[model samples]
Target: MTPDLEKELDDFKLSHYENADFDSLTKKTIQLYNKFERLKDKKKQNRVVLDLYTLYLQATEILFINSHALSVTVDRFPSALFIDSFNLRNFISENFAKTTELSSWFFKLIFSVLKDNSGTNEKYNLYTNLIKEVAKDYLGDYDLLNAYKHGYRVKANHSQTTLSISVGNGQHFKLNDSDSTITYFSKETRDGVPIVLQHTLNFKIGRIFGKCLFVCSLLNNMRAIILLHYKKPVSSKDISSFYINDKDEWNSMFGGSHFKQPVFSLKGLNKKNAIPK
Candidate 1:
């Protein structure tokens, strides 16, 4: 690429990194939540909600990175940071991998706790199914995320508005009559081509963003329901234990101020009060 084109590409990529209005709120809300492990004040609880919403916004911001990656690849712009350009795609997929990993873990933790606490009644069963639907709808996304995380081959092949994903792992080989081994490359294929998706980039990215938002909404709804229905008060530790397995990991990523103690809780006091079924 020419120097002017390279500059333009850099400018384009940099644009993706621009801050949103809620970016400051995201940082502030997280800071406030971290400052108080168990927020008793109603105002603080509202801040916690904002923090959760901030997470959804951050996840959505990832789409800009996603869009930038595809644009870079399709344009075939070579960057000093990403000489192959394909690395950008891999990098974006890797982010998705991490998101899915954490989101899945969160959902599992919440559902497991709720399931264990509920009685074997139809109401509880229906609630469980509702949780299942969220997971079911995004099941493929979780699979793709896992594939990317494990170094299983995953790539997006795009031509204009049409995008197809190739997902597979490992290689196959055969020995010829001469005893020479031949290696084969596998792509997630449909009728001998990568799975063709009749969706535009906007659609695919929007779907991903929507799923992320749904998870955030789930977190909000689950907390509210547990507070309203469950007789026992749920502690922040109960919720944090499921997500924060490694202190070192959290400390390195978010600093000691964050995750030093449980930062989430139900919307009321510790007293046990029964909520209607």
Candidate 2:
């Protein structure tokens, strides 16, 4: 990387700081981006460095947005849960190794789905908020996935578009919902079930951006999964505990802030299990 490139990256960092509604950590992410960009230019264009950098920035923005967005999204709901990124990353990496087979598969699926997937022609500015690449499946857990949601929803609803994935090695995984409603009820269903999604690696967006994660969210008998998964895993208990009015956030949650707790299942009954109806 030349001095000019470094200066350009520095300028990019300044712009994100001067422009982005991120946090101190996010500012640090800009620095990380600069470092990674330099490495990417010189280190033979390795994709891992770029992917890690993207996850770092995305997660940072999510942390900031979760704090800020929640305050305004619902006054009654408690402020965003704050935890150090180091600790949070450690938590995710640790838990991921121990997660169930389905969960691990799900995390891999989210990245592959997002990575191999593309097409954002709607009114939503997801293109700017999200980028595509060989989406990495590191940090496979709920927190990182939920963080993606909290951050992206700060502006748009991704559920506005349906999740299309090739599950179980081209088994065609479909998130059971119409396009518009998925993102609308994101927070509620992201974790209602036992499955979780991890981190994603995407095409370089010049360095300063966030990663996307996923979870399951539901609405009025509608069961759907929200991906671009994030950190900040919200339990059914936590979301359930929050008191919501008759009105839900039109741009966010559907049914008041309060939600129902559903039993999580790591095992499932596949078709034709010899059960006669």
Candidate 3:
């Protein structure tokens, strides 16, 4: 980004912070955290956790967009006004890349926990299958995020009548005249007329980030449950290992035993037979 654009974005974000509803955001986060803590069913737990993870991802996207701006020139206006580019370079490289890896790992581990702990395979299959269904879309997101991981740049340039962002080698994203629509040009086109692309923001980065945020929230909830139920560490590997090492011990200690004196059962006892014989 140009120096002017960067400055403008900083100012814009600062303003947003000043006006943002921290109180509401805080309350909502706490409410979800508490709900996650008390959940007993694995499916419900996973769903809540996903919601939290998606929230964080969405928040990160908002932060990145708020922090960056693009300068666009117009035919009639004397100066270019700044607009958000919603670029994925910073969000992906700095934070969401690691998040994507961890979310996948966490999801698999949580599924394993459900499958292992449950008595019936049908219930586990029901929940895990749901995740698999929703997860198909996230798989596509992983593909897009993989492209940005290996050091990509997003820069915007403008002539008097047109403005575009240079996304990659021979890949330019231009704003369509109709509001926030974007267009793409690529090597396959060979300098042909630009192809009208769908909204890259909502489809690509936004969708992925939203899914990550959902997963993150559920992961946090799972962490809380593990801490409470197992008294174990929050690290995924550690939690799994601790459960493995301690499961037998828990069963031995808590499983079943008979008292020397019967307190509740009255079998083989009658009024006359009550006397020791």
TM-score of each model, paired residue for residue: 0.25, 0.24, 0.26
lDDT of 1 by residue, 69-110 (tens): 433342453343243334534543443333444334334534
**Each candidate's lDDT (Cα)?**
0.35, 0.31, 0.35
Error of 1 at 113 (Å): 37
Model 1 residue 32 distance off true place after TM-score fit, in angstroms: 3.5
Residue 116, candidate 1: Cα error in Å is 39
Clashes (candidate 2): 31
Q: Candidate 1's C-alpha lDDT?
A: 0.35
Clashes of each: 0, 31, 11
Ranking by lDDT: 3, 1, 2
Where does candidate 3 stray beyond 4 Å?
1-15, 69-86, 90-277
The lDDT of model 2 is: 0.31
Off by over 4 Å in 1: 1-3, 14-26, 35-38, 43-47, 63-71, 74-277
- For candidate 3, give the lDDT: 0.35
- TM-score quality measure for candidate 2: 0.24
**Candidate 3 to truth, TM:** 0.26
Writing each residue's lDDT as its tens digit, candidate 3 over 103-131 gives 34434545554425544445334333333
- Give stretches of model 2 more than 4 Å off: 1-23, 40-202, 205-277
Tens digits of per-residue lDDT for model 2, 1-277: 6778666654543333234332333345455556645653433333334334335545533533332322232222223235455554554344323433323433333333232233322211332112221112233223433444554521211122334467676687753222111111122224433332222222223322323221110010011012112222323322201112332232232111111233333336455542222
